[model samples]
Target: MLPSLAFLIVSCNLQPVSAAGTDVVSCVFPFVFDGRSYSSCTKDGAIDEQLWCGTTSNYDEDGQWKHCSLQEHGGSSGGQPCIFPFVYKNQTYYTCTEEENRGFWCATTRNYDRDHKWSYCADIRLDANPKGPCVFPFIYNQTSYSSCTTDGMSNKKPWCSLTNNYDIDLQWTYCEPSGGKRKRRCEGRWGPFDTPV
Candidate 1:
């Protein structure tokens, strides 16, 4: 009888560590993120889809495992760096790292003048390169345009028009100087008017 009692004591002491504590429910898919392991299966009668091992102190409560809230344990993809040459408002923009440290930002080529359109440069992970082209405004034929590609005056002709109202087609006619007096010969400049001749 004493030997049987000693054997029972040894058997109880030799129980598995997990058996001594709470039992974990089997999960089909498990994933780890942000130093936390999560299972894609929920506990019995649990409304939530995923279950976190850290939710419960013993990972089980009254034979029911705790489920993780979608709001609390949902994975986040925020805080990602930005990419360069992105188009905003129909214009291409590039990132500048030098100005990033100074609290400056990245903006589209057209938005370089506007202060509000710029976004945090560091968020886009821009690389510092002094030689990189920076957007600058240029005047051509009494019109203002912004460009980061050309260093100096571009060889391309400015989209000059006779009137301010112009479209993408840029359909306009060029007129030659009349030397202060209307030409006697009708050469495309004259319109229907009462003449004293």
Candidate 2:
């Protein structure tokens, strides 16, 4: 049997830290899953699992070895979802719902239209497995779309659809940083992209 895994909820246990000049409550715990350690869920695959956090497994005779991001143990049960920082085609992705939260959910892109349902990663389908740091799709200008990993802010212009396969007018929105008017190119098929202007 492998080591027992546990899900540590930081909100349940808070620690006090000084930030700026005021005391702030924080809960930052090292995630240890089945003897594998993870600091944050950021990198792709298991070996690079240490990208956000470090994890090791002794399942093999080689002692504690880092597995691929997707192969790492994340949920409490083998059938449960894997943790964040999973890899797909060598790119590290995060699946958590909130942009700031990091864990197994980052491995797959959540279904933004489906009540925060995480059912796809890099366009691939996932059933019940939720562990992620998954790649998300880029939908722009109501008609352009692409994957976040593939699009780049080239020529100071937003990355547009590279293929004719994507249809414009699907649903596009402009994204601007909070309190700023400069819009950055971003994509999502069915949502409003807004910034505090």
Candidate 3:
């Protein structure tokens, strides 16, 4: 009785399809299913094909075609929507959407490196102000600094630091000596430092 019950469980999990000839041609890597390309292939049977993520092919303990594990998205559960947040440099971004299997959505942010500032995600609805660059201010070793865009400047650079000590709401200022005393000589292309009027 136990053997019969086990056979029924196994049969219910197996998908039935019309079997073709034994010489079935396996699907190639990056298999396109429902218009999306999968990175890997699992089992290649006469009647059905199983494709997933990772390498182009899968191997079994006996060196045969097998199904590789599916890639798991962050915060995913029971077919529910997943919004995966990732931080780069210092800014936060999200990925994945309510729709299943759809690829990442694209958006602009200040979390870029020296090259680009755009990233792909599932959605960008959470972005309050996508048009403007994101600014991040931080303090280190009793000195405050800010990272902001230089769009309107003459250089048209993406990132530049405030010349003055950074504050949450205070105005920016140039780096000056403390106690109104001239320490080391200010030497740069801007010429010698002059006392503020």
- What are the runs in model 2 whose C-alpha is more than 4 Å off? 1-65, 71-110, 119-156, 159-197
lDDT of each residue in 115-165, candidate 3, tens digit only = 233322312122211121122454323454454333323444232222332
TM-score of each: 0.19, 0.20, 0.19
Best-fitting candidate, scored by TM-score: 2
Evaluate model 2: give its TM-score: 0.20
lDDT of each: 0.28, 0.29, 0.28
Taking the tens digit of each residue's C-alpha lDDT, what string does model 1 give over 1-197? 12221242255442222320122221112333233333343332222322332222222221222232222111111212333433444433333323324332345233443423333332113111111222224333444544321222143212122223223322222123234442111111111231101
In TM-score terms, candidate 1 sits at 0.19
Instruction: Single out the weakest 10-residue window by summed lDDT for candidate 3.
Output: 183-192
Question: What is the alpha-carbon lDDT of model 3 when measured against the actual structure?
Answer: 0.28
Which segments of candidate 1 are over 4 A away from where they belong? Answer: 1-78, 85-93, 97-128, 131-133, 139-145, 148-197
Deviation in angstroms for 88 in model 2?
Answer: 21
- Return the lDDT, model 3, position 93: 29
Find the 10 residues in a row with the least total lDDT in model 1.
Answer: 183-192
- Where model 3 places Cα greater than 4 Å from the true spot, the runs are 1-38, 41-46, 52-79, 84-197
